[model samples]
Structure formats: C-alpha cells, structure tokens
Target: MIIDRIDRALDMTSAIVAGIDGGQYADASLCAGWTVRDELNHLVGGMRIFTARLTGTDPGGEHHDDWLGDEPANAFHLAAEADRAAWRRPDALEGVIELGFGAVPAPAAAAIHHTEVLVHGIDLALVTGQEKLVDDQECERLLGEMRAMDFSMFRNPGMFGPETAVADDAPGHRRLLAFLGRAV
Candidate 1:
C-alpha cells in the first residue's frame, strides 16, 4: 500500500515535469540554491545511485561520494531527467536484486526511489507553484525512514546539538524534514 502511494506520486510528478513550460526549468526553487529542474534531476539521480548499489555493480561502496564530481543540483537535474525517461522504459519495472542492507531487500531500493520521487516532488511543486499532495501511507513510510535515519546526514554537522530531542509523535513528514533541518 505504501509503495503503491509512492508509485502513484511518482507518476503524478512525471506528469508535472512533462508539462513544465518553456525555460521554466531554469527558475529558482525553495531548495535555496537549486532550481526545479535541478531538484527533479537530483531526486532521480540519487535513486540511480541506489539502483547501482543494490545491483552489486556500484563498486564495493569504495566511492564514498560518487556524486562528488558533479554539481549536486545539476547532478540531480541531469540524472533525474534521464531516469524519468528511464522509468518509461519497459525494463524499468523488471529491476530486482539484493546487495543487502539489513532487512531491506533490493526492491527496498524501489521504496527509496519512490520516497525521493514523492518527497522531492513536493519540493519541486512548492518551488514551481504546482499542486503536490502526499498520500497518508506514503507520508507514514517516509516519516518512518526519516525518523530512523540520522537525517543529519543531509545537513552540515553541529547544526543540532547533542541535547536536542526530536519528538517521535511529531507529524511524520514534517518530523522527517525537520530532523534533517529542511522542515522549517
């Protein structure tokens, strides 16, 4: 059910992307430093990285920051555009393999991909003045992961003092983003 909501959200996001008007792609976004196109691309590119890793073809994880070589925003925009197109490919749905991450199977990569698509789609919509809605289930799953993950992973260090306490019962999606310092 959660995955279904995510998949639906991704599909809606793709539709929104397809309708973007001329040069609207270059407009600035709420991401502070990134544009809508850049955010979409970044969102999709991050998924591809997970795809590669789950396939065991990502290389012993030795490359700590594979995306380090490219502009983070551009990396996402360019990669996401390609990936968005790739999702249209017939083989896209056939992907499934396990590189292992605790109980998370390779298909969990699909979940992660869905999460990025939906959550970042909201970001894109917010910046582009588009309509974006997240299903309750999808929000729950994302909020769960956001809580489980340190979230500081996306932020600069020392931003949250060790004494800070995140209330578990806080609204899930907001909790996730806020913990990452993006909810504000």
Candidate 2:
C-alpha cells in the first residue's frame, strides 16, 4: 500500500542521508542551484510540513528554512520518524490534506510525498556515489504512476523540467530521472 511505499522511500532516503560525508554537503546536486545540504534540508522540511499537516500541528518553519543546522542526518531521521508516524495514523488517508498550494486528497498527498522522498533520495545518492542504495523497483513504479497522470502542470523551472531524452535501455532509476527532466 501507499504507506508501505512511503516507508520504503523514507528508509532509503534516511540511509542516503546517513551516508553523506560532511564535506560533500556543499557539493552541487542535480536540482539547479541546490547543494546536497540544500536538497536534504528541503527534504527534511517537506517531511516536517507533511507531518504537521497530517497531525494538525504547526510545522514551525518555512519550506526553505535551515533544517540541517549541525547534524543533517539526525535532522532527517527525526523528521522521517515523525512523517512515518503521521502517515501511519489510523485515519491519515481518509481526508483531504491542506497544502501550501491547495487541498489535496490524502492518497494523492501520500503519493506526492513518496515521490518526493524517493526522487530526492536518488538525487543525493547519485551525487554522493551511493547509487547502489537506490530502489529501482520504486523508481519504475513511480515512473509508471507519473506517466498515467497529468504531470505537465508540474513541468516548470522550479519543479520538474521538460522531459529529457534517455536511452531506452537505461536503468529504471536513470529512466525515471530522465522522465522527470533530470540530466541522467
């Protein structure tokens, strides 16, 4: 189910975050103008925001706030734990979630959260030489889901870019990244 997918994504992302070297945090990531630290901070913030929305609590900060103050991995772990718990709540997926953009059905929000966690995990893995940690099955699954949806609305400079071309024989992760406009 969706919660299981979210859990797997969160676990993978937490592993990637745990393996990041201190010095590599400043390195550039596939996301334009975002360093590894920036991407991680955003991921952590997203987790916190989603959790807050799910539990009806204040997130206490903005999306771009400095979430990775001293120990980035610890921050990610804490947020991921909270996010996982929130998603697992008995009635978590029974209603609409109010987001910054608008209200989204709970299932849709879970899928979006799963995609964000997995994709950002891949982004960190690729840049930090931890590609082996990526789950190809998850990528393929999300890619298929995205293909069936109207993803064009999210195709923009700050979100997903125009789909980039990739060899048909590329690995699932690479193909998924290419589909999301990452130069994989």
lDDT (0 to 1) per candidate: 0.53, 0.93
lDDT of 1 by residue, 1-184 (tens): 4445545766666655555564666788645676766665565556565545443345323323354243444444454555555444444445464423333443455665676677666666555566444344556666676667765543445433222335767555445445444533
lDDT of 2 at 60: 91
Model 2 clash pairs? none
User: TM-score for each prediction?
Assistant: 0.51, 0.96
For residue 107, model 2's alpha carbon misses the true position, in angstroms, by 0.8
Window of ten residues with lowest summed lDDT in model 1: 59-68
Badly placed stretches (over 4 Å) of model 1 are 1-6, 47-108, 148-176
Model 1 Cα shift for residue 99 (angstroms): 9.6
